[model samples]
Target: MPFYTYMLHCSDGSYYTGHTDDLEQRISQHHAGNLGGYTKSRRPVRLVWSQEFGERYEALRAERQIKGWSRAKKEALIDRRWDELSRLARSQSQFTLRQAQGERVSIVADAFEAMQSAAQTAHPREACGLLLGEGDCITAALKTRNVHPSPETHFEIDPQALIDAYRSEREGGLRVMGYFHSHPTGSPSPSETDKAMAAHDGKIWAIVADDDVMFWADDKDGFHALSYDVGSG
Candidate 1:
């Protein structure tokens, strides 16, 4: 079975990270205040972000790493500020230059929220959209029809939407910085098909699966995980 690494935004404005096999049930337990420990004292909690992993150890590893994050970095992730989140991730003396390739990518908070909404609305089926904003920051998410027949496992953005996006960009609207899609019942990380379809042109790919949202930078070398920051659009 799949495992999950999650973060809860507690009433005390603190973050709690954990791992589980059943995300909804686990979260419901937290909501009911029955899962004792730190969150019990914090009371009312909300899930801010989560990532799905195919392995229990992966989920555990992610939980441990997130638990070590400073409040600012966690908030950066909660806010979907990729650049700031990433810079901070590499800011620590212990961190190395291994995180270099994912430099020019980010998504505004409002945009991420929009993406989440779209993903949920199309649950059990993939949702696809365009990411738009100024420079390297994505400020908005525009949902488009998934023209593919098998949306549950595949997604194809409407061609007209792409055309319209380019046209608007040419006419001076928010540039189409990248695109986002939901995995519905899979990992947020790129799948084999995703990797195969990537154009490797330095575009940002924000994949939403379950409650977790992750950003990646696409290039010839492959997908480089990129951090995202949430911001008011």
Candidate 2:
């Protein structure tokens, strides 16, 4: 039997994270208020997310790690927004780089060209990819398979590809600066779903629309338009 890490949306609009060996029974306990702890007072809780792990320790570790996340990051995990989660894992000091950089993003010229070409090639369907580099300078835009069922309306990078990227980063590879996606028929701006899925970490989001590419910063306040330069960066 697998252990599980779960998150609950409490009636008070707060979130609770925990681990358990019996997901069904544990959720039942929370619903019945039998635990007599956080969920007791915050009754009428709803299970918003859960992930199964092969080991108890893994589940427990995930629970502890998630407990420390901000509400936005937690929601990003629940939504499986891999790009947002990637940057959200950065330390607080790293996030400060966005402020220190004067609200600007820098990208290599070829990377910009590649992203535009990808958008044009994937026309009528959404093209998605990972932005890789250090700090605010994007050196590459590595295209990933769009695994969303409705590719024309939405985009979801293959989770396995994202997992591989993170693993590579852990082994001293390029940093996961942010992500890129095309809006086949819309403006090069975040859509409603983008806003809802934002991690609120200080990461960049490049949107391609109508052959135009624009960059935005994901800040806690909301998405902010960012000026960018294309060159050696």
Candidate 3:
């Protein structure tokens, strides 16, 4: 018999996770309040997501994993937003690493070098790209077109490039860790315009100016400087 891992959207806007051998019977019990546990009180529960597993242990493990995820991560799973799920996972990992290491960031040495080269090549015109990787390390930098009206002092990553990156990520490519941009005549820092236009979604941002590069975190409070170490990734 097949085992299943399932998640329910409770009436109180919370989620409940479980594993069962008979998926239909288990959901019926929850709906009827026959099982007197967490879901019993949160009646009118709706089955939001489920996955089949060959073994009971596999289903049980999946149940436990979902139980530990944050609400945003859970919603991502329920909605099948694979790209968002990858980004949220990386953000969570980055948060924990920041707390443990005094807010330092890591990037692959090759990624950093690539960004520098791209920026220099686009001199006088801002260079822009997407930073791709898993967890907290930036492993790749994909140069993208700067579609802003005045490319010399501004940048806008081509919308199609952004879309394709997320699609590739859903197909098991590296996660979109963050972004990189250049300021040909200014310091490697967030311009006032950059702050005004940021999504502030807790992703890393790298600013390259001349031969120097600086990293920052576009978090809820605002952009803050981050020290970094180059690694093999």
The alpha-carbon lDDT assigned to residue 7 of candidate 2 equals 94
Better of 1 and 3 by TM-score: 1
lDDT of 3 at 16: 74
Off by over 4 Å in 2: 1-101
RMSD of each: 12.6, 19.1, 19.0
Q: Rate the local accuracy (lDDT) of all candidates.
A: 0.80, 0.81, 0.84
Q: Residue 195 in candidate 1 has what lDDT?
A: 93
Ten contiguous residues with the weakest lDDT in model 2:
91-100
Candidate scoring better on TM-score of 2 and 3: 3
What's the true lDDT of residue 41 in model 2? 72
Q: Estimated TM-score per prediction? A: 0.60, 0.56, 0.56
- Candidate 1 lands at a TM-score of 0.60
Query: Model 3, 1-233: lDDT tens per residue?
Result: 99999999887655777889999999999999999856777789999999999999898778755654666788999999999999998986785566525877777656876786677668779999999998777889999999999999899999999999999999999999899999988788899989999999998899987645778889998898786766544
Ranking by TM-score: 1, 3, 2
| lDDT string, candidate 1, 168-217, tens digits | 99999999888999998867889998998899998888898755777788
- For model 3, what is the C-alpha lDDT against the true structure? 0.84
Model 3 TM-score? 0.56
